[model samples]
Target: MPTADPASLFWFLFLFATFVWPAWERQRIHLRRLWKIHELQRRRGTRVITLIHRQEALSLLGIPLARYINIEDSEQVLRAVRLTPGDMPIDLVLHTPGGLVLAAEQIAAALRRHPARVTVFVPHYAMSGGTLLALAADEIVMDEHAVLGPVDPQLGQFPAASILRAVSRKPVAEVDDETLILADVAEKAVRQVQDFVRELVADKLPPDRAETIVRDLTEGQWTHDYPITFEKLRSYGLPVRAGLPREVYELMELFPQPAGRRPSVQYVPVHDVEPRRRRHP
Candidate 1:
């Protein structure tokens, strides 16, 4: 038998450490997440599913990318729903900046139709289409600092409401044919979102109150990226509360943001403590 050269062995070891090790680490992380998810399901006596999106390394090249709810996401979530028993409750941990309208609507519709209770937990923010999914839930549990965003439709980069307003200000004869066509589409997009949102909350809220909430959320009253905090969400008469299970927070920790630059926010980790008392003079 021929003996292997030292250079060949060194190169093999280097490649294994560089490629194989990282792959193993990622698989380990994935398994850990599944274990945590199972624990949450066991404790809550419900089927737990997560739709978490964040800046993470993607592909073998390790390119960092941010994700939104998409058709693939909808497919997986719908499949999960179908696999669950009708009587079993669903606990969805949602964290996204929103995504394609059709994908988000598909998820929302499936969740809304579930026979068992549906609860959406937001540890951070779930904006735009994310908010649409929250609206379909029977209960929304948000962190004190977590937020939801307006559901106003955005046509390309411009908001549909803004397009309508701009077109309304101009004389019909002065508006270009392309602009007029866009405005028409914008109007339809806004109306469609408003109607879907109204339908989602109809049974959950009084008719008059639901109508008001729908307008505020869909009429572009706020910017597309407006942060609707926990208090604001409650004020809108949404089924929202401020609190999260410890496991939910633990689950979030498992999905750490990708490493590259230094974190923008930092602070000492401390829990509850009583206020310091003033000493008597």
Candidate 2:
């Protein structure tokens, strides 16, 4: 028999080992580790940290359903964190679209209760509740483009419903009356949000200053691209500082103490925790 074509044999083995075997192995490893983490969470009481993103109607593939942090889920995580030894820090990686006000308040309260320091990492934007959660953190780390949104409470109601109610109740062509009614509605919405901001931030800032900040953030012409940048946050009399990505990276390597030092939460990419697989030719 012609000596087995050495090159063909090598290619066959290489394909089997590099392509087929590795793919199967990777899947197996992924599933195994996923199960292991679940079990570990169930068994050992460790520092429980969660990632919250925007709410989507549906989740694609294995992507996590993003929404404002769920109050219930936050409670569960807080319970777990509370179980962790007091000496261990609870590091929460938060990226959120800022969800329900009540939920955010609950999350903030839980963060406050934990004996260990709560460190929040904002790799990207964390608006509304995300910003509220960051306030509870001993330190907050932000990337260059990362932002926090105005803590404006957006009330959701059908504009059509409101207009119909007004039309049914009031005489037509009373333009001045209609304008005053609309202004009143707008003021109520602004006041509601201002009250909440007062509760969260007033203790940290002077009462009058806090009220003024809330008014500007909520009453100003809203913009989708608006950002509560570090400069703006400081100007509002909140304790905030600029964080460079490079500085955070170095700090992560060093793992310095957070207290007294400026809050230095690091933005860790998901790939840093779970790297992508390479394909074999």
Q: Pick the candidate with the highest lDDT.
A: 1
Report the lDDT of model 2 for residue 72. 74
Q: How many Å off is the CA of 197 in candidate 2?
A: 1.9
Q: What is the C-alpha RMSD of each candidate to the true structure, in Å?
A: 4.1, 12.2
Each candidate's TM vs. the true structure? 0.91, 0.55
Clashes of each: 0, 4
Inter-residue clash pairs, candidate 1 = none
- Output the worst ten-in-a-row residue range by lDDT, candidate 1: 266-275
Tens digit of per-residue lDDT, candidate 2, span 1-281: 67889999999998887568756755875566455444434443335365545433321133334455677767776676667787776766567777777778777777766777766667668887778777766666666567887665554542322443454575556657755566466556656666666666666678888877766665544443378776666677765655633423332332222223355576877767876699899
lDDT of model 1 at residue 98? 98
Poorest 10 consecutive residues by lDDT, candidate 2: 251-260
Off by over 4 Å in 1: 1-10, 266-268, 271-281
